[model samples]
Target: MKHLTEEDLVLLYYSEPEAPAHGQLHLRDCPECRGAAESLALTLNVCSEWVVPEPDAELGRSVWAQIAPQLEVQGGSHAKRHWARHLWGRPRPWLWVAPALLALLLGTFYLGRVSKRVESPVMAGLSNAARQRILAISLADHLDRAEMLLTEISNAGDSGAADISSARYRAQDMVDEGRLMRQSLAEQGDTATLALVDEVERFLLEMANSPDNANAAEVQSIRQRIDSGSLLFKVRIIESNLRTEGQKS
Candidate 1:
C-alpha cells in the first residue's frame, strides 16, 4: 500500500467531514498509515488546549439571535439542514482560494495604477519644447544610474570572489531604460543620441548577462573594454549635455 501523505493524515486526524472515504479505508488496512494518523491526532489534541478569548454569553446570544432569522429563512428545518451540511462541508479550500483571488485582484489594480502613471498624460500634454525637456531629464537620470553601475564594475579591485551580482541586475534594468529612451530619440531622427544609446545598451547587455560571481580576471576584461572604447566617457558627456540642455529649456 502507498504511504499516506501528511496532508491526507492531517485531514483524517482532524476528521474533516469532506475527508475522502479512500483515506478512511486505507487507515483501517494499513498499519503504517494508522500509526502516522494516531501521532498527528495526539499533536492536534495538544494544540486544541490553546487558550482562546471567549465571547460573553449575552453577546453570543445576541449575535445568534440576529443570524437565526436568516438561517431560518431557507425554508423550514429540512431545507435548512441540507444548507447547513453544504456550508460546513469543506471551508478550507475557500479559506485559501478566496484570499488568493483577492490578492490577485489587488495586484492587477495596483499595476494598472502604475501603468497609468508611467504613461502619464501630463508629459503628453506638454509643448514640443517642454516635451524635449521631459525626455532630457528622464534620459539624464537613466544614464546617471547606468554610468554608476559601469563605473562600479570598472573600479572593482582585483581580489578574491567579487560579487558583481547587484551591478549585473542593475545593468539589466538600465538596458530596458535605454531601449525606451533610444526609441524616443529615434522618433526625432537624432542619430547622435541614438548611436550613444545603442552603445550604452550594448555594454549594459554584456554586464547583465555575465555571471554574478565574476573573478578578478573577468572584472578586468570588462573594464578593459570600457577603457579602450571610452564607453564611460561618452555616457558621462552625453548625460551632462542632456542636463545642460534640459536646464535651458
Candidate 2:
C-alpha cells in the first residue's frame, strides 16, 4: 500500500481544492496515514490558538523603496525588472512552502507565550504535558533535519566544486527555524538545550551564506567546523532525548 506523501497530507490538512478525494479515503483505510494525519492535526490545532502579530502595512513598501534604488544602480533596468518578476510573479513551490514552515516555527514560539500570558479558557484547557510533547516533537524534528544536512556536507569527500545550492537553500530555512526554537528554548530556561541551538544556528548561518557552487576548500572548511565541535553527535543526543520525552509525554 502506498502511503500519502507529506505534501499530499499538508494539502489535505488545509482542505485545499487540489487535494484528491482519494486521500481522505486512503487516510481512513490506512492506519499509518491516519496516524500521520492525526499528528499533523495535533500540531496545527495547538498552533491555531497562538495569535501571530500583524505586519505594518508600509513595511513591504518601505523595504522596497530602500532596495529599488540600489537594484537600478547595480544592475540597470534589466536587473530591476527581473527582480520584480521574481518577487511579484506567480508563486514558486519554495515561496509557498517557506512561509508555511516559518509560520509553523513562529507558532511554536507564540504558543509558549500564550500559555503564560493569556487566561483564556481554551488556552488553559491544553495540558502542560501536551505542550511539552509539542515542543519536544518540534525540536527533535528540527535537530534531525539539521543533523542530516550537516552530515551530507561533512561526508562530501573529495567531490570537487560540488553544486550545493540545494543544501544552501535548506540551510537558509533551518536558520530561520533555529532562531525561533532558540527563542522558545530560552524562554523555557533550558540553558543547555539553548546553547546547542545557538551553536547549530551559527553553523547553519555559515551554510546559508555559502556560495551556490562551493569549491573543495569551502566544503572542507564547513565539514571541519562541524567535526571540530562534534556538533552532529550532540544534535543526535539531544534529538534522542527529545524523542524519549515526546513519547513519555
Candidate 3:
C-alpha cells in the first residue's frame, strides 16, 4: 500500500489525534512521514505557550450570581423581545411625520418673504407719486420767475443800460434755477414731467448762452418755441395734479 504523506499525518494529528485505528495505524506504519509530522506538532505546541488564565473559582461564581438577579429583575429575556417589537411596530410613521411638518413650516416662511418682495413695487409707486407732486409745484414757481426775467431783458434798450447788466445776470440766474429743478423732477420718477422739464432746460440753455447784446430775432425765435411747445400747459397740468393730491392727503 502507498505510505501516507507528512501533510496527511499533520491533518490527522490535529483532527483526530486520539484515533485508535485507521490514520494512527497508517502513521505507525509510515515511519518517514511520521517523523516529519511529529516535528511540526512540536513546533506548534511550543508557539502556543502563552496560556489564558482562568478567573478564581469564587470570583467567577460571584459575577454569575450578581448578573443572574439583575437579569431576572428586568423580566429576563422577555424585556429584549418586547423592546425589539415596539421599535419595529411604529418607527416609520414618526420618521415621516417629523420631516413633513418641518417642510411645511419652511414653505410657509419662504412664501411670506416672496409675497413681501412682490408688493414692494406698488408701495414704492404710491410714495413716488407724492414726491412728484411736490417737485411739479416747485418747477412751476421757478418757471414763473424765469418768464419775468426774460420780459425784463426784452424791454432793455441796449446792452449798456444801467439795469441791462443786472437784468441779464438775473435772467442767467433764473436759467440755472430751472435746470436744477428739472434735474430734481427727473429723479422723482415722473417721466412726463421729466420730459417737459428737459425741453424747458434746453431752451433756457440756448437763451443763457446768447450774447449780452442778443438780437430781437433770436429773442423772438425762443419765445415762439416756448409758446408752441405747450410747456406752459404741461406746467398747469402738473399744478392741477399737485392740488388734487394735496386735497386728498
Candidate 4:
C-alpha cells in the first residue's frame, strides 16, 4: 500500500475534530505521520506569535487625556448620530437626489432668464433673429451634404458597384434630420422661422424622394433651388445681427 502524504497529515491536523474518520484513523495508527503533523502544528503556532510591550500604569490616563479634547460631550450625541445618518444611511439615493436637485435649480434659473428675455420686446426680437440664424445654418448644412451626395453619385464609375450606397444613406439621414429641425422651428411660434421651415421641408422632401435613381437633371434642379433660397447668405447675415445684439445686451 502507498503511504499517506505530508499534505494528508497537514489536512488531518487542521481539519475539524470530525473530518474524515479514515484520515483520523491513519494519523493515529501511523507514528511517522503523527510526529510530522505535530511538528507542523508547532511551527505554525510559533510563526503566529505577537509580542506586545506592557505599558506603565499611567498609560490609560495619558491616553484618555489625549482623546478627551477630540471627544464631544454626551449632549452632542444626537448631532453626531444625525451626521452619521446623513453620511452613510442612503448615500446612493442622496447621490441621485443631489444631481436632480441641482439640475432642477439650474433649469429654474435658466427659465427665469429666458422669461425675462421673452418679456422684453427688444430681446425677444433678437432671440427670434437668432433662431432664424440657426434654422438657416441647418438649411445650409443640409444643402451642403446633399450637394456632396450628388457629387459622389455623379462621379461613380460604371463599375462603382455599391460605392455610392453609403453616401445615399447619409443623404437620406440628413433629410430626416432637417425635417425634424424644421418641425422644432415651427413649434417656436415664429412666423419667419415657420416660413423657412415650410420652404426647407419642401426642398428636403424633394431630395429624399427623388426618382429611385436620380439623374443629373434632378440634381441640377435641386441645386438651383438651393442657390435661389440664398440660405447660406441669410444665415451669415442673421448670425452677424445676433452677435451684435448679444454684445449690446
- Where model 3 places Cα greater than 4 Å from the true spot, the runs are 1-133, 147-167, 243-248
Per-residue C-alpha lDDT of model 1 across residues 60-79, encoded as one tens digit per residue: 88978856654422211111
Q: Which stretches of candidate 4 lie over 4 Å from their true place?
A: 1-168, 211-213, 235-249
Score candidate 4 by TM-score against the native: 0.31
Clashes of each: 0, 0, 0, 0
User: Residue 139 lDDT in model 2?
Assistant: 78
lDDT of each: 0.68, 0.73, 0.52, 0.50
Model 2 segments more than 4 A misplaced = 1-123
Error of 1 at 41 (Å): 27
Question: Which lDDT tens digits does candidate 3 get at residues 177-246?
Answer: 5555554555446677667667666765676666666566655665566677765556566656654654
Error (Å) of candidate 1 at residue 58 is 31
Error of 1 at 108 (Å): 22
Pick the lDDT winner: 2
User: Candidate 3 local accuracy as lDDT?
Assistant: 0.52
RMSD of each: 19.2, 23.6, 40.0, 22.3
In model 4, the worst 10-residue window by lDDT is: 72-81
Query: Which lDDT tens digits does candidate 2 get at residues 107-182?
Result: 6457656786645444355566666666677677778778878887877756667777777877887787677677
Report the error of model 1 at residue 26, Å: 35
- Candidate 1 residue-wise lDDT at 92: 31
TM-score of 1: 0.51
Clashing pairs in 4: none
Alpha-carbon deviation at 70 in model 2, angstroms:
32
